[model samples]
Target: MMGTIQNRDKFLNQIASRFNRPRISSPIGKPNWKSQPQYEVYKGATQDELLEILKEQCKKIHTNFVTTDLKDLPVVVNDVVIDFGGGPIVTWKDERFSQWGLDSLMKQEWPEQNIDVFEWDYTVGNENIHKAEHANVGITISEITLAESGTVVLLSDQDKGRTVSFLPATSIMLIPKSTIVPRMTQAAVKLREIHQRTGHVASCINFITGPSNSADIELNLVVGVHGPVKVTYIVINDL
Candidate 1:
């Protein structure tokens, strides 16, 4: 009996070894991923150098750059409903949004300004989340960072709803510069790991480089047509 068992194990091992193939080696082609001037140029920058590069890239994108501090955002979002889809560390829960709920933040910031903020569960695609797109702006959280390319990844997870990031005329995202990665492959690997464990794929994962812009009309160059005319990325440093 022992001999037979040993033989069976040996046979299985031999079969495994004979048929086992090395992992597939697929090569990504040029233009295989998103392209950006910022990433291409700063291929090998140290942490300190990266910070300077990020600041420069950010300044280029945002004509009016603002710090990650919440106090600074209200001034920029002058007349829009900010959907503070949580997961961002907020020091001032004292705000009306946190006090009465997200709905009240708009009411508090600018009484006349029409604002609608709410928290949604990401596991299930809630219908309310879709409404944010109709508004002039939509705000959400970020998942990955791209230091080289100056890009941010938005995972449609529970803490941060996906609709809040896409459906609005302007999509404002909060990303910490520290999370920035050099390449898209690194970002994809991180996302895959999250999906594998969570067993849920974000409805949409957006890689927003800057504002929604297109030069389609006779090459005239127009912005904010298909999506938010503006994409305000708030990079928090301290938090």
Candidate 2:
């Protein structure tokens, strides 16, 4: 045991040498994220301007975007689902979707197109979860949107399943305009504060920028190699 300890310490010292540091240094400043200047440019922006920046940034990353009013949400969602070629769809089980009329709209549109739509159920979710992965379209709610990076944050928990985004061929995130943040740093700060207050985080907090891509095979570019090839953000402007 004494010899093992010496070897471990020697290995760590060698690794630190590459960085030209003998030991780790204590972090500086208050734990408060306000001390960090990473997102000040965005956190200080006007709401309207932030929305515009989000749209522009999303386009740059090849994410399709659409703005709709509260009443028009169902219509827009239906359009996106249809455009993705009408296949099996996986969606949320939350009743809040009914409040938005998304549930009824999907029922009406999917059946007419001869497509099957499944809602995520936590109690019996494990056995059938794999089926959701090959769904033609996946619709889920987003907690936050980072405008500068065109990223949408999906905070998954018991009620919200992770497969809603990872398993689908096309992923559609439903977000409200109010959830949009100016930058990723601002989002990170908010998340840290939430964890400090609650003492726990959900199962996952997904930061999705765009569709999955890779250039590993033959040095050729490929999209959707690991996940969805097409991603759409449906921002409810009046939310």
Candidate 3:
């Protein structure tokens, strides 16, 4: 056993030395996302104008996509099952909760509402979380963002859990427009900050844009095989 351990250590050090590993350079300066075709820049002389512009731009992405302040989210989402088992864990006393009023929103509100609450952990979720897949829409908060690709990032960590984003047919992300940056490089920097502050690296990090789509069937496009078929992002902003 001792000999095996020594050999393993030697081999590891040899591999590490051969590669001349160096610390990754910190991201600096502006991001390259401005060059992407999908990126849209919406700004106004006033913050209120920016909010309206962003709403219109976001609505154009899909018919089902709706941009409303969290306060405007209907008390009841009709005909949809929502699961909050492994979503974000914000302060119980925060104003953020007032917008969605999630704790107050009840499954009983919908005649056909199905709601399941699950534990937030690293393993596969319980039956309640899995049952969330039957619902047409799923909502969750983002852990980070990749500005260049217009991608929302989720890490399998404590506050922002993973399962909530992957299981539903339609995923709705409530992102604050202020968090938006210019590129993926800036995103990496933000992630590093999270790691440094939290001292925990996420097991899985997902970068999702739009819906779960594929074009693998002899030149035909398909969607929603492994994840949500439709992805709608509601860019929430304060004007």
Candidate 4:
């Protein structure tokens, strides 16, 4: 078993003695900055402006961006799945799928169209990983989106597997317009709020920017070296 640090305060006190200062055990608050430039970008901008910024950034990142209302989300998702070469598809077993009216698409429509869909089930253990590894496409919802970078943030939980984003050849990320933020600074602030309120946070948080691309191999840019070759961001406007 892992051991706990029983002498944490003692150790710190000793270090403080060496430095000729008293040990500070209190939790330190965030420093007040002279100029909070981080909030300057897209400041006072509406959600629509942020969405526009995200769209422009998507073009540079080579991510396919689509905008649709909640009413048409299922249809848009279906078209994306078919465009990405219909299943075997993998997705998180999230209630939001049903909340967003995607129950029919995942449960009935896909199967009826002869496409294999797999939802990440924690009870089955590694079987989820096996299925994700072979899936043609994986779908997930972005918990928070960074407009400046076109980044989708995913927080992993029991039903949400991280592999669903990286293991597949193609990934489809559902973005609710309400989740869009100006930049990472806003995203970090939101995460801190969650931890402060709940005293807990997701074990893993993934910030995916388009598909994987690397230039490590002889300096030649290669896509899909470490993750999906294609990435699509479906933004739900009416959500």
Which is the leading candidate under TM-score?
4
The Cα RMSD in angstroms, rounded to one decimal, for candidate 1 relative to the true structure is 10.1
lDDT of 2 by residue, 1-239 (tens): 35434577677778899999885656767675546577457667877888899989987777899989889998898899889987788887776688887766777767777888888878885743776776889888877888888899988877678888888889999888888888877898879987999898988889988888787989987777766889999998754
Please give the RMSD of candidate 3 to the true structure: 7.7
Give the number of colliding residue pairs in candidate 1: 9
Candidate 3 segments exceeding 4 Å error: 1-5, 12-64, 74-100, 107-125, 158-161
lDDT of 4 by residue, 1-239 (tens): 99877988888889999999998878999998899889898899999999999999999888999999998999999999999989999999999899999999999999998999999999999999999999999999998999999999999989999999999889999999999999999999989988899898997999999999988879987877766999999999864
The TM-score values for the models, in the order shown, are 0.57, 0.80, 0.60, 0.92
Clashing pairs in 2: none
Q: What is the lDDT of residue 100 in candidate 1?
A: 23
Of the two candidates 3 and 4, the one with more favorable lDDT, higher being better, is 4
* Candidate 1 C-alpha error for residue 134, in Å: 2.9
TM-score rank, highest first? Answer: 4, 2, 3, 1
The alpha-carbon lDDT assigned to residue 168 of candidate 4 equals 89
What is the Cα-based TM-score of model 3? 0.60
Enumerate residue pairs that collide in model 1. 39-148, 122-158, 133-167, 133-168, 145-180, 145-181, 146-180, 169-228, 224-229
Tens digits of per-residue lDDT for model 1 on 1-239?
35434576566667767879543336857775566564455576665576566556765654223344455445544422343332221111123234323333444644444334444544545554555545555666557866555677876544555556556666666555566666576688788898899888886787877665677779975655665566666655534
From the highest lDDT down, the ranking of the candidates is 4, 2, 1, 3
Clashes of 4: 0
How accurate locally, in lDDT, is each candidate? Answer: 0.55, 0.82, 0.53, 0.93
The C-alpha RMSD of each candidate to the native structure, in angstroms, is 10.1, 5.3, 7.7, 2.0
